[model samples]
Target: MTVKLRVTQLAQLEMAALGGIGLLLLAAFFFQLVQGELPCAFCNLIRVCFMLLGSGLLLNRIYGINPWNYVLSGIGALIGSMLSLLFMFAKALPTTKPTGSAILGLHMYTWTFMIFTAALFFCLVMATLYAQRDSLESPGHALDARPTWHKGVIALFVALVFANLVSAFLQNGFDHFMAGGQQHYRMLYDGDVMKP
Candidate 1:
């Protein structure tokens, strides 16, 4: 094939890959919401990065006919990758009784981990796209690109993640894991409730 045709093919593939990343991120968000778990600080940061990269790739798919489309995608991918690395390093550290959505650590939300992984995965995909991006709109014939396997992967990831969350909550409830939180303390510890 001609050099121009080859470049176009690569671009299409990159776009499909970006789409895969977006779907994965979306799946993670859906899982978190359906599970009723709230995102903590770190989680929110990760979400922002994912949104940035995801939006960037999406814009490329939309207005990618322009050369600047690749530039936008590159910037978004770089930012997303940097943010992902920061959060991953901080979170990978041992858990420390994290309070209320700290940026350093995540909460007990299952989506916390899932979203982190999702963002990182998307960032990686975007970086690869930057390395390969040439024509922008898509690599090849968008209609022929089958992403069935990608969907399967995302479904499995989210289901198992959310299932784990439900299991943990159930175990905690059954075992009164919040016993410490349930403790009753008096302002004046005279004897019992108060001194006579």
Candidate 2:
């Protein structure tokens, strides 16, 4: 027999998925800090999309599940997948060098494309399934009823969002535009002078 999930169970699954995205963001930071592999403009765009997806998930967990939440995340994934494809295409060019190191024989953009595509598919599936079920968009599914783990996932995503904001400013400085293949943070200084 096919096991159908309750609305609460679906909400919990969304929380878990958001937590996984948080881990991915952390890994990106690790690469930037530990490996010194800075993200290109395209990479930053993909990261932004992840943030958008997380924001939608956050809204649902806080205000209860709604179709608008899916729309927000689905649009993010759709745009992210497109951006990933363009980045991959750039890497395909003869003179275009690869951005960052490859992981598991695939570039970061390639992996992101797969992830965005998967996320888009997931949103579609989940939205359809959620619509088919009974309308439990009531107080029965309030945030206070959820376990602490749900709040933990929200907290993790929120932290990552702020961390990414700080890191972006550090990388690009006040200009808000990072140079291609930038090696050091523009905001950093050496001795008495800032690196220009």
Candidate 3:
């Protein structure tokens, strides 16, 4: 016998996947704190894309699953893929140095490229599946009644978004522009540079 997931179940699964993505960011932040390695501008942009993707997933969870949610997330993944590709090629050049230490033989940008591509595919598939189903609400679970873990996931996503914003400000200052290779926070040391 074959079993099919209801729209609600699929949405919950997607949200869980997005939560995993959020944890990935937290892991990235952990590496930054422990290893004293700051992300470059490209890396930051990729992270922003990830946040955008998460935002789309959040919308679907809160407002109900829609094709537009997948579109929003797919756009983010597409942009992230392009940025990761550029970053990878830049690092691949003979003159340019790799930004962070490689994890499991592949650089972070390489992993991000793979991740974004996968996410794009995932969004497409989920959207198609969502389209195939005719019903929006399932009798199994009420949309209003969310599990505790679901709430945690949303909280984590929100926290990560705020943390990323603050980190960017701290690194690039009010002007939001800084050299990618700089080791120290421009806003912290350069008092005059903070002025726009």
Which candidate leads in lDDT? Answer: 2
**Model 2 global lDDT (CA atoms, 0 to 1):** 0.82
Say which candidate scores most in TM-score.
Answer: 2
Which scores better on TM-score, 1 or 2? 2
Candidate 1 — worst ten consecutive residues by lDDT sum?
179-188
Per-candidate total of colliding backbone pairs: 6, 0, 0
- The count of residue-pair clashes in candidate 1 stands at 6
Question: In candidate 3, which residue ranges exceed 4 Å CA deviation?
Answer: 1-5, 138-144, 190-196
Worst 10 residues of 3 by lDDT: 135-144
Measured with C-alpha atoms, the lDDT of residue 38 in candidate 3 is 77
Candidate 2, residues 1-196, lDDT tens digits: the string is: 1334466578778888899899889999999999988776777878899999888878877876688989999999999999999889988988988888889999899999999999999889888977885564662356677689887787889999998888888777777556457777766744464343
**lDDT for residue 112 in candidate 2, whole number 0-100:** 94
Query: On a 0 to 100 scale, what is the lDDT of residue 77 in model 3?
Result: 94
Better of 1 and 3 by lDDT: 3
Per-model TM-score, in order, reads: 0.44, 0.89, 0.88
lDDT of candidate 1 over 4-95, digit per residue (tens): 68656654665565555556555545644574343443444444544554455455444444435445544555555565555556546577
TM-score of 1: 0.44
